[model samples]
Each structure stands twice: as C-alpha cells, then as structure tokens.
Target: MRLFHSPASPYVRKVMVTAYERGVEDQIEILGSAAGPVKRDPEIVKHNSSGKVPCALLENDTPLFDSRVICAYLDSLAGREGTVYPQGADRFDVLTLEALGDAILDACLLCRYEAVLRPESLRWDDWYAGQMAKVDSGLDDLEGKWFERISGAFHAGSIAVVCALGYLDFRFSDKDWRSTHPKLAAWFAEVSERRSMKETLPKG
Candidate 1:
C-alpha cells in the first residue's frame, strides 16, 4: 500500500496515526505530495479527485480517499473490531467527534492558507476572521462538552482531536488555546505522548 502525504498535513497525520495504531504502519509506503486548494499534485489527483494528501492505495490496487475512509478501511484490514471505531450508539458519538475535530482542522488550515498562500493584496481579512471564529467555537465546545470523555483508549475521534490540536500548536501557537482550555490541554498532554502521535508529529 502507498499513502500520498504531506508532512505538515493534519489530515495525512491522522491517517498515519491510524495506520500506526492499527499496527500496519510498516505495510504502507509514504509518498510525499503537494496538496492545496491552489496547488495540486497530479500524481495524487490520479488517485484522489480532490488531489488531497492522505490518499491510500490498497495492496490490491483499490484507492481510498479521505482520512476518515482510509482510517476505517485500515481498521478493517487490521481486523480491529470495535476498537478505534466502536459499534452501536458509541459509534455515532465517535463519528460526531471526528467530524468536529476535522472541522476544526479545516478552519485552521484555511486560515493558514489565507495567510501563507494568498498574496497580501488578495487575502481577505473577513475570511480569515470567519475561520478563526470557527476555530474558537470548536475549541470551546470540545473543552465544555468533550473534555471529560477523553480517555487512554485511542479512537478515531480522539485521534482526530489530538491531531487537530497538534496542528494548532504547530501553526497557531501564539493563539494560546491551551490557556483557555486546560482540561483539553491536559488530555492532549497525555495523548500526545502516544507513540503514534509522537512518531507522526507534523514537521512542516
């Protein structure tokens, strides 16, 4: 299997973390790719229409796009039953949390691209502010509603959340989000120590 990835992509990191936790990291070969709204890698585009990182090609030549789909597929490949992704009612909760975490990353990435990719003259202040607002609201919700749920049992939701927080720390450290969400910060402190998280830390 081959995984299209960018070192600094939170989405790619999630997939890598998933592969690591599933004990199948060694089976996948990482292929660096440039993926962004304005810049696309043609090789990646061949596998994923969106030209995104974290796209995986299975051993049998099946292509998997999107971190969520790739992670779920990897879980199945590892014969992991109801672990990272639980079944029943717990599944929905985990999935919802994953969505929230992914959304946070979306906002953060958009804000980053706005500042770093777009020319100063073309950048829109309102757009950057809007994304930051989403980041703020998402962090607040996580701190208030999901802080107590964080556990040592690594799951898709928790993995996604940790990766999202990592991205913030990597790119928006000046925001001091940890100061406002101490519980989440503490939870992250522990989870970030996991071998998967540590090994997959974004390197820009």
Candidate 2:
C-alpha cells in the first residue's frame, strides 16, 4: 500500500501507529504531501477528493481514506481483525471512544489554524476558547468514564487517546494538561516508551 502522508498530521499518525502495531509499516510506501484546508495538495487529491492525509491506495489500486477506515484495513491486512477494534456490541462503544478522540483532535486543529494560519486582525478569541473547551471536556470524559479502557486494554480507542494527548503536547506544550489529567498523563508516559509511539512521533 501507498499512503499520502504528513508527519504533522495526527490522523496520519493514527494510521501509521496502527500499521506498526499490525507489523505492516514496512509494506507501506510513504508519499510526501502538504495537505491543508485551503491549499490542498494535488497529489493527495488523486486518491482522496478531500486531499487528506492517511489516504491510501492498495496494491490493486483501490483507494481507502480517512484514518478510521485505513486503520481497520490495516487490522485486516494483519489478519488481526477484532483486536484493536472488536466485534459485536463492544465495537460501537470502542468506535464511540475513537470518535471522542477524533472530536478532540478536530477542535484542536481548528484552534491551531486560528492561532497560526489565520491573520491576527481576524482571529477569534471566542472560537479559540470554544475549541479549548472541547479539549477540556474530552479530557475530563476520558478520565472519568474511559479510564478503565485506557488503562487496561491495547485497543484502537486507547491509541486514539494517546495520539490526541500526544498532539496536545506536540502543539501546545505550554499548556499544562497533566496537572488535572494525572491518570492520563501517567498512562501516556508509559505508552510513549512503546516502539510504535516513539517511532511515529509527529514531525513537520
């Protein structure tokens, strides 16, 4: 498989991490891309109309897209279905957890664009605050409700949470999220030592 990739994209990281966990990273060819909301990469558009990272083309030239789909595909490729993502009633719950993580990332990327990409004269404080509120709420929900899943299993949901928190540290290091989310912080510190997480640390 070939992947349109951006090192700085957390969604891309999600696919990469899943690939590593499935022992298929060696099989993927990384295609460099400069995907952006306004300035789309023409190369990526060939595979994904949205021009998004994590878009992939299989050996047979079949296209797959978005991090979630690609990660599931990787799980299948590894013959390890129902592992990172489970089967039955547990699947939807895990998918919901992944959605929560993605929502946090969505809000985070919006906040990042407002701060770095938007012009100073037009940046909205209200928007930034609202986005940060989502991040905070997400962290709180994970701490209160998903702590057991996060602390116990090595599933896709936990991977999403780790990548979300990793992005927070990568982009917003000055923000002291660990002070309140101590349990997550501790879990992250341990998980960071994993080969997959260390090798796939986000870079621009």
Candidate 3:
C-alpha cells in the first residue's frame, strides 16, 4: 500500500502508529506530501478529495482516508496480531473516545491554522480563542471522565488521545497544558514511550 504522508500531521501519526502496532509498517510505502489548510495538494486530492495526509491507497489503488478510517482499515488487515479495534460493547466506548480525541485534534488544528497559517493582517484572535476553548474543554472531559478508559487500553482511542496530546506539545509548547491536567500529563508521559509513539514523533 502507498500512503500520502506527512510527519507533522497527528492524523498521519495515528495511522502510522496503528500500522506499527499491527506489524505492517514495513509493508507500506510513504508518498511524501505537503498538505495545507488553505492550499490543497493536487496529487493527494486524486486519492482523497480532502487533499490531506494519512490517505492510504491499497494494493488495488482503493483510497482510504482520514485517520479514523485508515486506522480501522489497517487494524482489520488480514494476518495482523490481535486488533486495535476490538469487537462488541467495548468497541463503542473505544469509538466514542476516538471521536473525542479527533474532536480535540480538530480544535487544535483549527487554532494552529488560525495562528500560523492565516496571515497576520487577517488573523482573528476571537476565533483562535474560541477553538482553543474547545481544546481545553475536551481535555477537561478526558481528565475528569475518560481517564481510566483511555489509560487502561491500547486501542485506537488511546492512539488518538496520545496523538492529540502530542500535537499540543509539538505545536503549542508554550501553553503548559500539563500544569492544569497533571493526570493526563502523566498518562501521556507513559504512553509516549512506546516504540510506535517515539518513532512517529511529529516533525515540522
């Protein structure tokens, strides 16, 4: 399989992490991409209209996109050891957490694009703050409610959460989110030590 990949994209990191966990990382080909919020990559658009990184083309050239879908597809690959996406009731909880984590990433990416991608003359401080508020609220919910669920498992939910937190540290280093969410910080600390997480650390 070939993937339109970017090292700095948390979503791509999630798919890579999943691929690693499934022991199929070596089977994939990386198609370097320069995807952006304002300007899309035409080559990536051919595979996925969103023109985003983390787009995977299977052996037959069928495209899989967005982190969640790509991760699920990778997790379901034949001959994989165990699974990152479990079966039955627990699966819903895992999926819910994944959605929450992606929501945080969405807010983080929106804030990042606003502050870094948008021109200084056109940037909106209020919009930036609004998106950051969503990130903070999402973190609060994770720390307060989903801590045990996320911390207890090694599923896609945990992958998404870690990638989201990693992106925060990578791009918003000055924010000191750990100061307020110590438990989450500690959990993130431990999960980040995994080989998959270490190897796929985001780069600009």
Each prediction's whole-model lDDT (CA):
0.87, 0.89, 0.90
Residue range with the least summed lDDT across 10 consecutive positions in model 1: 145-154
Give the Cα-based TM-score of candidate 2 against the true structure: 0.96
Error (Å) of candidate 3 at residue 196 is 0.7
TM-score of each: 0.95, 0.96, 0.96
* Candidate achieving higher TM-score, 1 or 3: 3
lDDT string for model 1 (1-204, tens) is 898888999998998899889898888888878787877888888878888888999768679989999888888888856458988677888888899999999999899999998898999999999999999999998899876554545799998999999999999878899889988888899888889999998897
Off by over 4 Å in 1: none
| Cα lDDT, model 1, residue 90 | 77
Per-residue CA lDDT of candidate 2, range 40-59, in tens?
99888877899888899987
What tens digits encode model 3's per-residue C-alpha lDDT throughout 34-138? 898779999999889988888999878899888898898888884545798878688899999999999999999999888888888999999999999999999
* Candidate numbers, best lDDT first, in rank order: 3, 2, 1
> What does the lDDT read for residue 38 in candidate 2?
85
Judging by lDDT against the true structure, name the best candidate.
3
For model 2 the local lDDT of residue 109 reads 95
Model 3 is weakest, by summed lDDT over 10 consecutive residues, at 73-82
Off by over 4 Å in 3: 78-81
